[model samples]
Target: MRKKTTIEILLFSLIICMVLSAVEGSVPILPLDQVKAGMKGKGRSVFQGNRIEEFDVEIIGVLKNVEPKKSIILARLKGGILEEAGVISGMSGSPVYVDGKLIGAVAYSLGTFVKEPIAGITPIGEMMSISEKRKKGPVFSPQVPVKKHLTLDELFMLNKDFFLSKAVFHSEGRALKPLSIPLVFSGFSSYAFEQSRSFFSNLGFNP
Candidate 1:
């Protein structure tokens, strides 16, 4: 009886360790160095009505030094309505996993009306580094002076830095820009919304 009880305790301990290790490995990060071209992965995001959906990702290649000490993973995304809609504006920062390990997030999109849902992924390592920096200190402060009346061009010029950045790539006279975010307006008249639509679009918001 003593021997049997000892054996049972050992088995229980082994099972507990296995469970813990499995939990730890479930969301492991795949390092950028190990990532290669032609890797296939799946990304999760909400396409409609808060329902999380999965999409397929195929790695094209890695863009080295896209920014100083940063890299972007180029990939072609498919599945769901991606082929019809292309990369949706708000799909940025969706986690992409390759070989059951996270590689990066969808952050940049190919030019408008592209034939495919090609995207640029900001690597997990780079994102983690940015998060670490944010924890160190305050990284941004908004101090823009608001003017009561300004023309569309003047408004754009005032926020030019916020509206534009260095393009990720240029193809066929189109620059890879950040995916525009969709904005919903409530309690506004149709005329007001229409009037401001172009202004918001220039600032990367699709109203």
Candidate 2:
């Protein structure tokens, strides 16, 4: 009787841990229906110097990307509300939530120094799709017991400093001698760089 009770208690404890693990590993991507054009919301952006800043943003519009329509929200730092922040140099991956539902994350800048100061808001769900390795399958391999693997977010963050260095070069273009600065002096936002690469390539720019 004592052995049976101990086993039962252990089994119940295991069940609770499994449930919590599933919830912890899962990421919430905003449902398509929950997002729309011109939605107003609050957003959080991580900037240079490892600082996080929050702001108010308005959804400018949605662009259809093959299948998923992407949400593009424009934001102004709380301090610069009226003039427009133009999605500062290092705010990519900012999370935008509307009425408590996360709608999208800051993906890239639409253009440079535009008067209206708009930034491209990439739906978190859409960006998530890029990081997804497989379709219609369990996220883990059954053959091998699951151990903590690098998450898309974690991997990207680890490479963040490298990305920022690239951004510095792109800003100055010709005058900015790539060799003039140490590798540590520059950076690139993955979101912005990828966006530019895609946009230019689509227009027939050379590789």
Candidate 3:
């Protein structure tokens, strides 16, 4: 059966009101270890004009150890505004559910300029760890809180120093990096964005 109900919730951000919604009620989360390829699912996110909408997701497979203990799940998306916009950048962290069971968050895109709506999902297990860390404190990794109003470039520079300091003494003798943070650039044209990429990259950002 297809679900057609829409629930809207207002999310107030720094500069705008973003409306996000999901189906009401509790949904059991599917464990990462039990997720398999070919399973069908549904994901929810804001697609057009701040309206929350639903989309389809079909699991392709799980890529293990993509970065240390971390893993990524590949899934092809369909339906809703995805047919028009493809996998959008702002849709990151959209909740994905399989058989009414929560599976993961839409975290990455295959690339720009793709005809297909393929996305990389961050497993619920890994996402939960991030939430747990946040609960323990606002300061992730270094236990030091940064002051407000720092730009994206400034944050990257601070994080680079934090990672280097940890690399010096990790018991495994390897660097322990933090989870990736989303970087959003608004109101920039292709030429301007390209020109500014190097400026951000030099500050230890991937751009």
Best by TM-score: 1
lDDT of each: 0.70, 0.44, 0.58
Which residue pairs show collisions in model 3?
none
| Regions of model 1 farther than 4 Å from truth | 1-26, 139-168, 171-174, 185-207
**lDDT by residue for model 2 (55-167), tens:** 77776555454222433334333434324554454454456778876666555554555434455555555544433422333333323322244232432333232221222
TM-score of 3: 0.59
lDDT of 1 at 22: 28
Let me know the TM-score candidate 1 reaches against the reference structure.
0.64
- List the lowest-lDDT window of 10 residues for candidate 1: 139-148
Q: Judge candidate 1 against the unseen true structure and give its global Cα lDDT, from 0 to 1.
A: 0.70
Please give the lDDT score at residue 23 for candidate 3.
21
The sequence of per-residue lDDT tens digits that candidate 3 reaches over residues 87-135 is 8766766889999999887766665565467777778777565445434
- TM-scores, all models, native as reference: 0.64, 0.46, 0.59
71-107 in candidate 1: lDDT tens per residue?
8888899999898988878996688999889998787
Candidate 3's C-alpha runs over 4 A off are 1-27, 137-207
Q: In lDDT terms, how accurate is model 2?
A: 0.44
* Off by more than 4 A, model 2: 1-28, 66-85, 134-207
Residue 32, model 1, lDDT: 91
Error of 3 at 53 (Å): 1.1
C-alpha RMSD for every candidate: 17.1, 14.9, 12.2
